[model samples]
Target: MKKIYFLIALFCTVLLHSQERYFLNSDTRLYTSPNTSSAFLGYFRYGAEVRLLSESQNGWYKVQADNFNEGYIQEKFAATRLNAKDVKIKDAENPILEGGDAYYGGNHLFVLVAGLKARALPDKNSKIKEILFTGDPVAVDYVPVNEDDWVNINGNFDEEYARYTLRKFIGLRPNFETLIKDFDNLDVNAVSERKTLSERIVELAWNSEYSKLEPAYQRYYEVVKQINDPKLIAETEMNMALAKGLAKHKLPEQIIAFTKKAEFSLKGTKTKSLYLSQTELVKTFGKPAKKANVGDECGIYLSDLFYYYPDLEVSVDEKKNQAEIVKVYINENNKFIINPNTILDNSVSEKAFIEKYGTYIEASLKSPHNYSIIMEDSQFRLVFKDGKLFSVEIFFYC
Candidate 1:
């Protein structure tokens, strides 16, 4: 037995030495791409230690965690070791506690020894998102896949493991029958935080793949289309892509064209059609300044220039076939502004949400009974009740 233990320890030490390390002596930088010249996403703080996935040729290390592995890290921070002690738990692994289950859906794990320091995410290079680090014993959850590798964990909101390294904790499965009594005070807030964390993963995945704002604004439009929150979906489409496109692309709004096309030069010029379809109007004058819609029925966009001159009133009929332009009161306050469109989509997925939302909100709103709320600029709010979805609401400002 002594020989076995010695051999295992020796092997671990050798593995650690072979792997590279990145030091968070200062603001540890997180990059968007594997190349150093890529845009920066964020950084880790001082006194943090992160392991490198591999050694790069250009004096850079491919370190994982803190969402920084997307790019190569400077070689100066590389460490020549891996020092994580093998984790083991007592008892048959019980993933779902009677009343304690942290539901953030990434790679999760439970600390085997009582009172283990659960850091934010899985690595030291990651940012701190939660206000609390400790969690109720019952709140701890895990999935043991093999004797040496646990698949998942249930840590407190801030005491989370990284999604990618969940397999590392499989050795710590505890038998439910022999486990001590679960924490009497089940923290509802912790559960909600967990759910939010899960959602954040979804957001991040979505943004990473679609929200890079590349391939033009088509991806943003697709995301909004999948969202049930009409308000958010509408608002994001209008504010982020459509509006920006109008100004940047020089697309004219359809409604405003009615006024523009009507030539007052011929006093009482009898026109065949007063109002025109936004698409048709754009063809006559220019493309839309900004436009976003849900399906083909509901959507709202604005023109580049507002008719500040009260003399012209632009109104569209229900059929969208006619427009009546007449003299009306004009208010300087009612100005036509081009706003960018935001991305809103249920399809953003769970992994994407975690990457985007992070852990700050989860730890701050640590209420056993309280839930999670995600708000964007589009007057759209997503509410989760007791760690699950509660509601999604959208409203019009005007």
Candidate 2:
């Protein structure tokens, strides 16, 4: 065990050592890209140097300067040696442009509206420098970006950004999750048709191959979790489940929906629908009635399996509120349903179901409540009642 662990550690160490770091030249601006046309994140005065984290790629150096976890700069403006003093003069092209406030209007983080391009001189027509993808982080100065407006990246690197796209794109750097959680409160929907852009990006990630999902979804996934709205959470989680199902099981949501006898099959699964799982299924158990006593009147649950709700029902015995046994039934009559309001047929075979859900813990079940199949990092739980499919329940920290 120790030897195996040592090999793993050694391999990781070697991998880390393979990448190289370098220094940026003093008295130049650190643009977000290798080209000179890109928006300058900040000016590195003479004697000011930044850390580079990798070999130059396409004439651009990957950096970790300022508040940025990953950033880019041109090779033309870097020096191999460190400055002995911090007295170097600032450059003119990328002047700090502050009206005398050291904090650049007192804010330190910003973001680019989807598709906003960075310009050479903060002027839209000054020759487009770089194109910022939707949600790309931006660093800037406080002065009003004149092409339309100006923002300031202050900090060791902090800058102000426009909530909506403007001459200069800028805003706060509070992580995607925070921004999205409060999307209903912010006024950043003007650029890139932000609402559409947000959905489009996430949808792309949902459909992307597993290996291709990183860097792309790395942020949005985190954001969706922090959102408080149940509708939004369900929508996002569903997207993620589909993406995972595709990656791990090679079964698209369509097939999954086809296997369930739910209402979603009525219209057919949407092209972007999520692979429904235990989390959504368990939601059907809204509030299990409290049990009164051992054989008390445990009311029977009505069947409501259709379009949105799966075949699910919960029955609890109550002698007046004492307590006994509560039974949750996810009957076989349930159907698989998907979005844009579609319904999957009830004719899907057991083989098709296994293909998407993977092998179960126990090949054969003797009782419904005795077995369950889990998926999505245990976010869902599938209960089998008396050797047959029963109900789905949320199992994660949920």
Point to the candidate with the largest lDDT.
2
Predicted structure with the largest TM-score when compared to the true one: 2
lDDT of 1 by residue, 1-398 (tens): 99999888867764674453444333335455556578653333332355555535576665544322344556654444323431222222233333323432322333333223333455545554432222213122332223333221333222344331233322323432222112113243355433333323322222232222222233333444544468756444433332232223212243232123222111222223333443443344343243322222223222222222222333333255443322222122221111112222324333233334322122111332121222221222343343332333222233
lDDT of 2 by residue, 128-174 (tens): 54554544444342223244543323223313322223534454322
RMSD after Cα superposition, model 2: 21.3
Cα lDDT of candidate 2 equals 0.40
Worst 10-residue lDDT window, candidate 1? 333-342
True-vs-predicted CA distance for residue 128, candidate 1, Å: 18
lDDT comparing candidate 1 with the true structure: 0.34
Cα RMSD (Å) between model 1 and the true structure?
Answer: 21.4
Model 1 ranges with Cα > 4 A deviation: 1-22, 33-36, 66-69, 80-398
Task: Give the Cα error of residue 386 in candidate 2, in Å.
Answer: 47
